[model samples]
Target chain A: MNKSSAPRQSLGELLPKLVVAPTFVVAVIFIYGFMLMNAWLSFSSSRMLPKYDWAGFIQYEKLFANDRWWVAAENLFIFGVLFIVICLLLGLFMAIFLDQKIRAEGAIRTIYLYPMALSFIVTGTAWKWILNPELGIQRLVREMGFESFTFDWLVNTDMAIYTVVIAGVWQSSGFVMALCLAGLRGVDDNIIKAAKVDGASMPLIYRKIIIPGLRPVFFSAFIILTHIAIKSFDLIIALTGGGPGFATDVPATFMYTFSFTRGQIGLGSAASMMMLMAVIAIIVPYLYSELREKNNEH
Target chain B: MNIKRVLIYSILGFAALIYLLPLVVMVITSLKDLDEIRSGTLLSMPQALNFDSWDKAWGAACTGVSCEGLKGYFWNSVLIVVPAVIISTVIGALNGYVLTKWKFRGSTLFFGMLLIGTMIPFQVVLLPMARMLGFLGLAGTTSGLIMVHIIYGLAFTTLFFRNYYISIPSELVNAARIDGAGFWMIFHRIILPLSIPIIVVSVIWQFTQIWNDFLFGVVYSSGDSQPITVALNNLVNTSTGVKEYNVDMAAAIIAALPTLFVYIVAGKYFVKGLTAGAVKG
Candidate 1:
C-alpha cells in the first residue's frame, strides 16, 4: 500500500492510472452503460428507432404473450439441458478412458478438440449436410440395405433443436474432456492407491469417490456450456435458419429476429434484458460464493 | 482385465471416429463436384480429385448481391483481426500491469466491474453499440467493427494478462521504482520479457475468438465490410439456381483454415489459453 502511494506525486505514480483509464471508460460505456441503455429501451416505446418515453413493461408483456418467444425459450431449455448433460457424460467417459494411458493420446485428443477451433458457421455448415436426410446418413443407410431408415431430424419440427445440440456437443465436448483430464491429474494419487489397496473395484471407486470429487470441474463445464447454449445464434442460423417455422429458434435468434428484422425494437430489448437477467441469475451467485470462499480463506 | 482393456480401446476408437467424421466429410465434400456429391454417400471417395469448387469458392461464388468470392471478406477478417488482436493485447498488458503492480484505491472494485464485462451477453450491448457506432460515423465499416472487438475483447485479454502478471513478485517492480524507473520503463524492461507465454496465450485466444465471431460481424458491419464468418453464412444460405454444396463446403473450409492452422501449430498454447480463460474467478 505504501509503494502504491507516494508522499509527493510522481509521473510514475500517475501513469498506471492513466494507462488503465481508457479501458475503464470503455467498460463503463460498453458493458455496464450499454446494459442500462438496453434496460431503458425495454421500458420505452421504441420500435423503429429508440424513443425516450416510458411504456411500462409492455414489451415484456408482448414477449410473454408471443408464441414465438415461448418456443424459443423452450428450445433454449431443451438444448441447454441436453447439450450440457451429454457433453458431461461423453467428456467424462473419454477423459476416464484416456487417463488409462491410451496409445497415441495426442493424436486422439487433437481429433477430439479440432472442432472447437472451427467457427460455429463452419460446424453448422458441415452438420447441415451430415444431418440432411436425403444426402446423408439416411440415404447411406438405405443404400446399405436398411430400407426403413428414417433419420430426418434436420427437417422434423420436434427434432430440429436436437440437431443444434448435436453440433454444439460436437464442438464443445472436448473442452470438457480437457478440463476433466486436468482435474483427473490433480486428484491425489495416494488416495487412489489407498482405495485400490482396500480392494475397491475401479468403477466403484470412480463412481463413489473420484467422480464425486470432480464436482467443481463439472460445474465449470456447466457454466461454459450454458453460456454457449444461450449465445447460440450462428449454429441455429446457419444450420436450420430457425425454420420448420421457428422450431429451433433460441433466445438469441429470437431477439435478433424481433429486434432487427421485425422492427420490434422494444420487444427485442425486453428479450435481451431477459437474457441479461438469466446470465446474471446464474453467474452472480456462483461468483459471489467464490468471492466469499476466498475471503474466508484469508 | 483383458475384456475391460478391449472395451476401453474400442470405445476410444469409436469416439475418435465420431470426432473425425465431420472434418473428413467436409474435406471430401469440398473436393467432389455437384454430381458426385449428390450421387455419393459421405463415406464415398471422389471419382477424381477436383479443385474447381475451391477455385470458384475462392474467387467467383456469389453471396447474395455480390458476385465476388470470399477473398475480399477473408482479407476483411484479416484486416479486422490483426490490428484488433494487437491493440487489445497491448492495452490489456498495460491494464493488467496497473491493476496488479500499481494497485490504488478502488482498483479491486474496478477489476470486479471489468470482470463482469467478460460474462456480458453481446445482445445486451448490440442496440446501444449500434447507435454509438452511428454517432461515431463508423457504422458499416471495418474500423467500427475493429473498435467493437477491442472494447468487448478487453475483459478477456486483460483477465488473461492480469492473472499471469500476479505471479510476478512485486519486489522486482518496487526495486525498479526505487531506482527511479518509471512505470512504462519498468514494464518494458522487467515485465514484458516475462510475458511471452501469456502473450502467446492471449493472441491465440483473441485471434480464434475474433476470427470466428459472427454476431458482432453481422450486427456491426454491412455488405462488403462483413467478416468471413458472416460472409460464409450468407454464401451458404443464399438460394439461387443451385445449392452448390461443394462451393459452400469449400468456403467453409477457407473461413476455418487460419484458426485451424494456429491450433495445429500451437495447440499447447491454445489449450493453455482456454484454461487461463476459464479462471474468471
Candidate 2:
C-alpha cells in the first residue's frame, strides 16, 4: 500500500531474494556453523569451557572406553527396538480393528491420539507417578490382597529401562495407529474385495495382501519414531532423571549431563556427535529417496 | 460374527482406557491432598474437589529458587511463542513464495541446505549456540531464546509452506505479473489470501513446539527466564523438599493445557501439520 516503493521493476526483482537472504544466512551459520563447532569441540580438549585447540581422537577414545556410554548405547538399542516394534504391532492391530465398520470411530481415535499432543515431559511425569512402587501399581496390587506383588521397575536398576519403554510406547504408539489408519484408508478396496472372494480370511487378507502394501507408511513411521527415540531428552529427564544410577541414560541425556551439568564439554560434544551420526545414518538415505521420489512424481 | 464384533469393540474400549488413564489420574491426583493421595488408591477420587494444590502449583510452589509457581513461566512461554510463531510464519511464507514462484538459480540447493537444518540433532548445536548467545550478549534473555527458536523453526515452517505453495498453480502469479503486480503486492494480494490453511498448520505446529520445548529453555536461559517446561521439570525433580505429587501433577497439566487445548480445537490442522512434515521431530 505504500505509493512509490512498489512499482519499481528492479525492486521487485530484488525484494524476493532480499526477503530470503537473512534466513538463508541464519541456516548456514547456526545449523551448519554450530555443527562444525561441535565437531571441532569433540576433537579438542574442551573441559569446562570450549577450547579450539586440536586433540584428535581423544574424546572418542574416552567415549568408547566409558562403561556408561556403553550402557547408554545398549539402552538405546533395547529402547529403540522395543519402542519401534511394539508401536508398530500395537498400532497395526488398533488401526485394523478401528478400520472395521465401527461406531464412535472419531471419539475413540481422539482418545488414542490425544497422547501425541501432550509434551513428553507431561507423559513422563504421569508415568513416573503410575510406576512409583510405593505409591503406584504395586501398592494398589498389595491393597487388593496380592501381598507379594512386586512391580518395582521404577527403582529396580535392571528393569528400570523397560519402564521407559512402557512410557515411550504409551506416548507414541497412537501416532503409529494414525499413520496405519491413513495407509489403510489408502488401500485399494478392490484388492481386499478380491481377496475376500477367494475365501481368504480378514487376517490373511491383511497379512498377505494389505500389510505388505503399507511399506511406505511403515518407512515414514519408522524414520519419525527413530528420530524421536534418538532425540528423547525430556521424557527420560522427567521420568527417570537418567537415574536409578544412570541405568536409563540414552545418548541425549548422556550428552546433556556431560556437557552442561558435569562440565566435560569434550565428552559431551563426542556424545552429541555420535547422536548426530546416528540421525545422519538414518536420515541421509531417508532424505535421498524421499526427495528423489518427490522429484519423480513432479 | 457377533463374537467377532464384540471382540473388536472390547479391544478398542480397553485400548482407550490405557490411553485415558494417565490423563484422568493426573487430573484427579491434582485435586487431592497429600493425605488423600497417601490413603486412597492411585485412581481414587478426591475428597472435596480441592483447589488447594492448583492454587499452590500456579502461584506458590517452588520452581528452582523461586517460590512463584508456573504462572510466571507460563507467561514466559506465551511471550516467547507468540513472537517466534508470527515471525517464523511470515518469513516462511516469503521464503516459500520465492523458492516456488521466483526460482532463481541455485535456490534449490539453498532449499536443500535449509531442509538439512530440520534434521540436525539439537544436541550438536547446543554448545556453539550457547556461546554464540553469550558472545552477542543475549544469553539469559527472552529475546535470545526467540531468536534461537525462529532460526531452528524456519526449516519446518518453510517446508510446510513450500509443500503447500507448490500445490498452487503458477499461472495465477504469471497473470498477476502481467497486470503490473510487484513482489510484495502479489504476495499480499494472491499468495496470502490462499495461505490460510498452511498458515494454520505452521502456527499450530510452532506454537505447540515452542510452548513445550525444554532443551533450549534449560540450557540457554536461566533464573526467571526459564519456560514452564523447564520450571515444571525442576519443580517435579527438586531434591530438597518433600515431593508434593499434587503440585507436580497440577504443574504438568498446566504445562500441557495449551497444546491440548489447541489439539482439541483445531486438531484437524494439528494432524495435518504432523502428517505434512514426516521429517519433523
Candidate 3:
C-alpha cells in the first residue's frame, strides 16, 4: 500500500474530535458549572458572604423546620395540580371545539391568545382589579342591586391561592390551546371519518380515539405547563405578593420573603434549595415518561 | 358551516368576551378619570373619555422621588431586557447547537442537567443566585438583573432551540462539516437562518419573562435601576398611601404597552412562534 494512499486517518479521527470536544467543554463550563457552584454555596455557612466552611446539612435541616417553607411546599402542590389540570382540560376543550371547522376561527383563536401577549404583571394587576372585592366584580355586582354576591377570593385568606390559579389558567391556557390546536390539526381526517363510519358520536370519538392519539401532544403540553407552574414566581408575586398572611405563598414567594424581605440569607438559601428539590421531584418523573415515550416512538 | 355552526360560534364569541373582560375593563378604566372610575361601572364607557390618567401614568405618576411616570423606568427596562434577551438567546443557540451537532460523551447527562435547571423554580434559586450576584459585586445593579434573567432564561431558550434544531436534518451539519465550516460559521450561516421562527419564539418568551419580572427586579435593583414592573408594583401596592385605582390601572397598561405592542405588530408571528416546535418534532 502506498503511504499517502493509506486513506488519511486525519478525517476519521477529527470527526469525533470536532463534534465531541467543544460540546464537552461548553457543557461542563457553563451548564453544570453554575449548578455545582450553586450546590456548593448551599452547603457552606454562606449568608451575604459566601464562606466555603462546611455547614454539613445544617441548611437542609433548617429548611424543613421552617413553617413558611412547609407552607410554600404545600402551596406548590395545590397550585401546580390545579393550574395544570384546569389548563389542560380547558386547552383540550378549546382545541377540540375549534377543530370543528367553526366560522371566524382565526379571529377567535387570536382573541384567546391575546392574554399570552401581555406580561404577568399586566395580567396580575388587571385581574387583581377585576377580582378586588371593593373595586372589582363583587363591588360591581353589589352596586347593581345584588347585596349577596361576593367575589372576594383575591383578598380572602383561604381563597387567595385559588385566585392565583384562576388568573394563571387564564393567562396560560390560550397558549396551551394553541399547542393542542396544532396537534389536533395534525390528526388525520381519515381517523375521524373512520370513527364516524363506525357510528361513534363526536364526543365519544374524541374520548376514545382522538385523545388516545393526542397523547404525545398532551404530554408535551403537560410538561411545559407543569414546568411553568413549578417556576411560577411572577404571577404569584405580581398578583398577591404571597399575601393575605401567606395564604397564597408558594416556594418562590417563601424563598423571596426570606431572602429579600427579611434578609435571612442562610434560611433563605435553605428555602431556595428546598424549592429546587421540590421542583426537581415534580419534574423528573414526568420528564422521564416523556423521554421514554419519545424513545419508544423512535 | 350552517345554523349549528353559527350557534357554536356564538357560544365561543360569548366565551371570548368573558376571556377578554378583564382587559376590556382595564382599557375602559384607563380611559376614565378618577371620579368616573370611582363611581361608574367598569364595563361601561366613560362619561367623557380622558387621557389625563394615561398622561400621568406615562410621565407624572410618583414612584419614590421620581414623579415621572412609567416612561422614566422605560429606559431601565430597555437596558435590562435588550441585553438580557440577546445574551440569553445567543447562549441558548450555542447550547442547542452543541447539544445537537456535537454528541459527545456525557452529552445526555448535560442535557439532563439543563432540563433539571428548567424544572427548578426561581424561588429555589432566588437566595443562592442573589447571593452569587452580591458576591460578584454586581447586586442591586442593572447588570445583576440581566445576569439573573440570563440564568433563568437559559433552560427554556435552550429547550426551544434544541427542539427546533431537531426538526432540521442532521445532514445539514454533516454538509457544513464537509464544506469545512467551523462551528460558529456553521451556526451563523446555516442554523441561525433556519432558526428565525424559534428565534422569534425565544424573543417573545424572553421579552415577557424579563419584562414582567417583579421579584428578581425587586431584589436585584433599587431606586434608579428599578424596572417598570417593580415601580408599577410600588405605585399600586403602596403600604399606606391611598390606592389610586385609575392611575394604577393606567400604570399597569403603560407598563405592558411595549410587550403588547410587539405582540400586536407581530401577532401572527407570535402565535406561530409559540406553536413552532410544539408539535412537528
Count steric clashes of candidate 1. 0
Question: Could you tell me the TM-score of candidate 1?
Answer: 0.97
DockQ of candidate 2 against the true complex = 0.78
Give per-residue lDDT, candidate 1, residue B44.
88
Please give the ranking of all candidate structures by lDDT, highest first, separated by commas. Answer: 1, 2, 3
lDDT of 2 by residue, B154-248 (tens): 99999999889988999999999999887888889999999999999999999988988989999988999888899999889776557899999
Greater-TM-score candidate between 1 and 2: 1
Q: What is the C-alpha RMSD of each candidate to the true structure, in Å?
A: 2.5, 2.1, 4.4
User: By DockQ thresholds, what CAPRI class is model 3?
Assistant: acceptable
Ranking by TM-score: 1, 2, 3
Every model's DockQ: 0.84, 0.78, 0.43
List clashing residue pairs in candidate 3: B59-B69
Best by DockQ: 1
Indicate whether candidate 2 or candidate 3 has the larger lDDT: 2
Instruction: Tell me the TM-score of each prediction against the true structure.
Output: 0.97, 0.97, 0.88
In candidate 1, residue B164 scores what lDDT?
92
TM-score, chain A, per candidate? 0.96, 0.94, 0.87
Chain B TM-score against the true chain B, candidate 2: 0.97
DockQ, cand. 1: 0.84
Expressed as tens digits, the lDDT of each residue in A53-163 for candidate 1 is 899989888989999999999999999999999999999999999999888999898888888899999999999988889999898899899999999999999999999
